[model samples]
Target: MPYLGLIVLVVMIAALIDIVSSDDALVRGLPRWAWLLLVIVLPLVGSVVWFVAGRPVAGFSGRVGRDRPGQASAMGFPEYDHPGRFVPQDPEADAAFLKQVRERAEAQRRQGEIERRRRVERERGQ
Candidate 1:
C-alpha cells in the first residue's frame, strides 16, 4: 500500500526523537551517534533494533542499590537528596538556617492573613 511508506517514515521519526531525547549514560548496545546513523540509514530495521536493544528498561536506574545515593542517608526530602547538593556541614548553622526559614514563612503567612482581613473589611463597608 502507498500508506506503508508514510507509516515507516513516522516510525523512523519517532525513533529518532526517542534516541535524541534519551539520556546518553542510559543508552545500551551502541553509542547514540551510531544508533542515529543506523536509524537514518536503515529506518524500519534500525527502529526495531533501537526499541529492542538500545532502549533503557523501565525502572532500571543503571545503579546498584548500594551505589545509589541516600538509600540509608536520605534527608527525608527527595529533591535535596542528590549527591552533589549543598548541605551545611555545621549542625548549628543548619539549625539556624532552618529557624530563619520558619520565621520568614510565619511572617509571610501573618502578612497574608492581615491583607485578607483588610480586604474583607473594605468589602463589607462598601
Candidate 2:
C-alpha cells in the first residue's frame, strides 16, 4: 500500500506542475475543481490526462529567450487566442503604459512646434 501512496504523491505533483505551468486556455477548458478531483481520486489517470490535454504543447521543448526566465516560448508568443500579449491586471502597469504614450505624444508635439517656429523665422528673415 505504501507503493500506492508514493505513486499518488508523484501523480499529484505532476498534476500540480502541469496546471501551474500551463496557459489559461488549458485551465479554462478543464476547470480547476475537475483537476483537483482527478488528481485526488485517480492519480495515474489524472496525471496522464493532464499530461496529454493539460499541457500547452505536446512535443514543444524549446524555451523562451535566455534573459527571461520561465517564459512560454521564443519571441514571447501568447498562449491564448487574445488580441494582445497577456498582461497582468495591474492599475499601476496600465498607468505606466499611458504615461509612456503621453510622453511620446508630447515629444512629437514639441518637435512640431520647433519646426513651426523655425519656418516662421525663416519667412520673417526673407
Candidate 3:
C-alpha cells in the first residue's frame, strides 16, 4: 500500500515535469495552463490523461517529428538529421557553400555601390 502511494507520487511528479517542460504548441487538447491545473487538481488521473493525450509522441529514438532550428534530438543531445542542420559534412560542399555566400555578399555590395552612385548623380544633377 505504501509502495503504491510512492509509485503514484513518482508518476505524478514525472507527469508534472513533462507537462511543464513540454512545448506549449505541442501539447494537444487543452491549453498548457489548463493542463497544469488539471494535473495539479487531479494528480493520478491527470497524469494518465497527459500521457495518453497531451504528451507529444516520441519519434524514432525519442526525437520529436518536427525539427526546430538548434533544437536537440529526443536523446537530449544534438544530432545532424538533415544536411542543413549543420555545416556540410563534405569539405567540398562546405567550400562551395562559402563561395556562394561570398559571391552573394559581393553582389549585394556592388549593387549598393551602384545605387549610392546613382543617388549621388541624381542629387548633383538637381
- Per-candidate TM-scores read 0.49, 0.39, 0.48
> For residues 1-126, what per-residue lDDT tens digits would candidate 2 score against the true structure?
769878778878978777766555435447766776776687888877877766555544332222334544213333322423344466476556656776898999999999999999999999
**How many residue pairs clash per model?**
0, 0, 0
Which RMSD values do the candidates have, in order? 11.5, 12.7, 7.7
Ranking by TM-score: 1, 3, 2
Q: Give the TM-score of candidate 2.
A: 0.39
lDDT of 1 by residue, 1-126 (tens): 999999999999999999998766568889899999999999999998999999866565423222343463223334334433444567476556666776898999999999999999999999
> By descending lDDT, how would the candidates be arranged?
1, 3, 2
Per-candidate local distance difference test: 0.75, 0.63, 0.73
Over the full model, what C-alpha lDDT does candidate 1 score relative to the true structure?
A: 0.75
- Of the two candidates 1 and 3, the one with more favorable lDDT, higher being better, is 1
Clashing pairs in 3: none
Which one wins on TM-score? Answer: 1
Between prediction 2 and prediction 3, the one with superior TM-score is 3
What are the clashing pairs of model 2?
A: none
